[model samples]
Structure formats: structure tokens, C-alpha cells
Target: MKSGVFFVAAAAVAWGMGGVVASVLYRISGMGPLAVSFWRAGFGVLVLVLVQLVRRRPVGPRALFPRGWVMIVIGLGLAVYQSAYYLSIAQAGVAVGTVATLGACPILVAIGARLFLGEPLTGRAVLAVGVAIAGLVMIVGGPGEVGPHPVLGIFWALVSAAGYAVVTLLTRRYADRIGSDDVGKTLASFVVATLCLLPLAAAEGLLPASNATVAFGWLVFLGIVPTAMAYTLFFNGLKTVPATTAAMLVLIEPVSALAVAVAVLGERLGLPAVAGTVMLLAAVAAMSVPVRRGSRAAVAAGAAGFDRAAPEPAVAGASEASGDPASAR
Candidate 1:
């Protein structure tokens, strides 16, 4: 449980930073969302491939594409979500866009899990989600200029949220079957996603007009930190953490992202936003507390169909308990 929390929280921080960086990139590079999304995935693929080469791990199609069709769907989903999110943040202010997109995710995941996975939606989970969302409302409602086309931005945000929800559920559903080569899985998905976005990005022009070293550096940082590192950690965490809990844990993104925005983007953080941040942290902290062995939360988790201590399959030359398994398609 501790490991799961750590992974998810760390990923959320990286994602939060990435969001701010992306906004900056937009201003400097003048790149469209499609182009930016393409580069993010493209650079991420390079990093993962380098890791594979450095470790001398051969990522064959069989290992990477455990389920060919599903992997494709996951990759497409990733492309859609990433592009849509960038669009949302571009059209909506970061706070509004992030809150709308992320806030909708846990709700969607919870409903999907209940319907498809038979996971019992405990009352405690409901309360936690409600509290987290309230915090989000306060954060976005506080001092901040609303972006142009907020309604359109929100529409795109919802689309991003729905796409992400599908990807999360599919990953969780197939974690056991995908074996434990999380790195390979993430790499494969990025490869496919990059390919999917390439045509659109090319149409929009791939390279930024500015040749500034700092702009390129930011792009690299976006790929390595958020795209590669954050996702690897997130997929590993999802192997043990239930989908709903993982969704809630990611609410940390808005808090951390808003902090970065205030510091770097000159965004205002009023008292209401401060109070909301505190409230949001409390809710996430509460969610992190381990459920008692026989508690209702524990029972609900058991019903969700994953075991934290479950031994991973023998693959990728890794031991059963040595490291976390891949939860990507």
C-alpha cells in the first residue's frame, strides 16, 4: 500500500510540473496541441528505447504486444487523451481544465469498475471523492482569470477524461495478463501513440519556430520527466492500487500544478485556493491510509480483483517480488 501511494503521488507531482511546463512551451514554441503531444510521445519513446538498450533488454513484439488489438486501443486512447488535455489547457485556464478533466476521472473509473469489475463502491470512497472534488471547486473558483471559450474547453476536458478513464480501466483489467515488463509496455504504447500523432503533428509543423536552447530543453524535460518517468511509476502503482483509488490520488496534480503556475506563470492564489489545497491534501492523505485487514475498504479492494502481495508472473527475467509489474496494455 505504501509503495502504491508513493508511486502514484510521485507521478502526480511529475505530471503537475509537466502541465506547467507544457503551458510555458506553448507560449514560447507556438506549437499546436497536436504537435506538442506528438513530440512528447516521440521523445518519450526515445528515452525508453535507450533504457532498453542500456539494460540490454530485448523488447520483442511478443513481450511488448501481449494483446495486439488491446495494445493498439490503449495507444490510441493515450494519443486522444494527451492531445485533448493539451487542447483543454490551451483553451481553458490550467486550473479549470485540469480540475474538469481530472475531477471527472475518478467518478468515471468508479462507475466503470462497479459495472464491469464488480468492485463494491464503498461509502468511504464516495466521501473521499466528494471531498477531493470540493477542494477542486474551491481551487478553480478562487482568484483566477477564466480562459476564453471555457465551455468548449470543458467539452474537450471531458473528452480527455473519458479517454483516460478507458485507458485506466483497460490497463487495470489486463495487468495480470500483461506480465511484469512495465517498461516495455509503456514503451510500446508510446511508440504507437507517437506514430498515431505523427501525421497530425506533421501537418501542424513539428519543430517550433524558435530555435532557443531553453525551448528545446523544456521539450526534453516534458518527455523524460512526465511522459516517461511519471507513466512508468503510474503503471507500476496501478498494479496494486485499485483504479478508483489511483484516480483520486491523481488529484494531487491540480494542487502541485497550481503551485507551479503561481510561481512560474504569475497566477494568483487566493485564500480560498489555499484552503482548498489544504483540504485536498487532507483528503488524499485520508485515502492513503491503509485499510484494516477485515475492514469494508479491504473487502471492497478484494472485490476489485487485485492483490498487493500477489506474485507476478515469470517473465522479463525478473523475480516475483523483485519489482512492480507493468500495468499498461
Candidate 2:
């Protein structure tokens, strides 16, 4: 079946809960940051495996590791992205960490695409990026959080963004060729991430006791909902949205998180948050609008690549390279 609009919306909805879900898992598991990273991936793989079986799809190793060690290369980046991102948020504080990582990712992805894929950005594109970065700044400082080491958070954020950027570039460059479907690519990332975290999770005593119902439940949700469903929606949406567009659309995640918290979870939305969210969303929307026909073509081409991996002009890419070490962009 043809997929585009539905996938994008679904991904948006699914991933909207990203922060909330991560926070929930943290609350219940009493697990350290590393453990949360490990279980999310491990359980996510398990769920995907089950989903593949239910779909009557054959699960083979063939489509999984094609293009030689490229998956591993990408996977290593994924691991770093995931771990560093979480660490950044944990050590540095979410606001500083989030902005540094997410705000910076698109810039790096654009650069990577230019260098590797021969994609170049126009003046409008550059302006769009700048607007978005400004919005990102507002968002990070919004709600007026103060800390001693904002620099640490910013440092982690940049690292996370860098790592996620690598993941996006790899996916755009190689996913269609290696995996049977985008699911295969996502699975590969999760599997590789799981392996990478096994040792750290083990060392940090991050594994759940299996008998602990609440913790296990949190772990399972981490995988099935945010991990599996989120990626699925992203891939599906990637079919319709341009890589640059999709990456920007992701800015909606933080907004969605705040809305969920305020409306559903009885959290507060301070003036800074509301203002920042508006600015950020506006920036994201502006960044996604293609002023030129070629820019529009980039979006459609990105859609085409879903059916088959075809090259598209570089506008921007949503690299999973977060300042977080654990997340795969």
C-alpha cells in the first residue's frame, strides 16, 4: 500500500509522547540512565520481532546486514547518539541538553548531505535553519531553568545532535538498499544499539528483575510504544515528507510533550514555555516551506525514496544524531 500522509501523522502522534514516555520509564524503573537505554532498545527489538511474525513476514538475517559493515558503522553512531543524548539530558539538564542536541542536528545533517550526497542549501534554506535555531534557543531557555553547568548540557546536546545526524545520513544513503523495509533499518539500529548497551547496562546493573511488574511494564512500553511505534511512524511519514521537512516536523515533539503534560498530566505551562513553543513551532513551519520548485522537488523525491532509495537534493535531514548517546536519529 502507498504510504505518506498517514505515516507522517502517525509518527508525529507516536513520537509526541517521547519525553513523557522516557520520563515515565525513569520514574518506575528506578533504573539509571544507561539501563533505560538498554531496555528500551532490547524490548523494542522484541516487539518488532513479534510484529513481523504477526504480519506473516519472514524475518531473515539477509536484509539485515547488507552493505557489509555499514550497518555497524551506522549502529555505532546510533549507540553513541542514544547514550550521549540521555547522558546529556541527565547530567546537563533537559532544556540545555535538548536544545543543544536537537537544535544543532539539522545543521550537521545538512552539512553531511552536502559533503557526501552533493546536496547544497540555498539562501532561503539557510535562513530557515537560522530561524529554527533561534526558536530552539528560546525553547531551551524557556521556563527559565537555571543550573551551574549549562555548558555541560550544551556540550552533551551538541554531541547528541552530531550522533543523530550521522544516523540520518546513513539511513538516507543506505537504508533502502540494506533492509527489506524501513522497519528493517529501524530494527538494525535497535539491535546494534542493544548490543552496544548490553555491557554498560550490565555493568550499571540496569537489567530488570523480570518479576518486577511495574519496572518490566515500563521497559516493555519503552520498546513497544516509543521505540517501535515511533520509528514505524517516522519511516512511514518519511515516505511523504522530505528529509529536511521531516527533520523539522520533529520539533513538534517537544511541543507535544508540553501539551500532553499540561493538559493530560496536569503540568504547568509557564509563559516562557508557551512563548517558546509558539516560536519554535512557527520556526519549524517556516523552515519546512519550500520557496522554490526545486525545494518542493526535494520533498517529493524524499517521498519517492521510500518506495526505492533514490537520491534527492539536500534541503535538510532529520538526523537522529542527538547530543544524547543512547538515541538513534
- Give the number of the best model, judged by TM-score: 1
Candidate 1 ranges beyond 4 A from true positions: 87-96, 142-153, 262-268, 296-329
Estimate, for each residue in 194-219, the C-alpha lDDT of model 2 and write its tens digit: 99989988888875544368877767
Candidate 2 Cα lDDT to native: 0.61
- Against the true structure, whose lDDT is highest? 1
Candidate 1 lDDT, 189-235, residue by residue in tens: 88889998999899988888774677778878878988889888888
Runs of candidate 2 with Cα error greater than 4 angstroms are 1-9, 142-153, 208-211, 290-329
Backbone clashes in each candidate structure, one number apiece? 0, 28
- State the weakest 10-residue window (summed lDDT) of model 1: 313-322
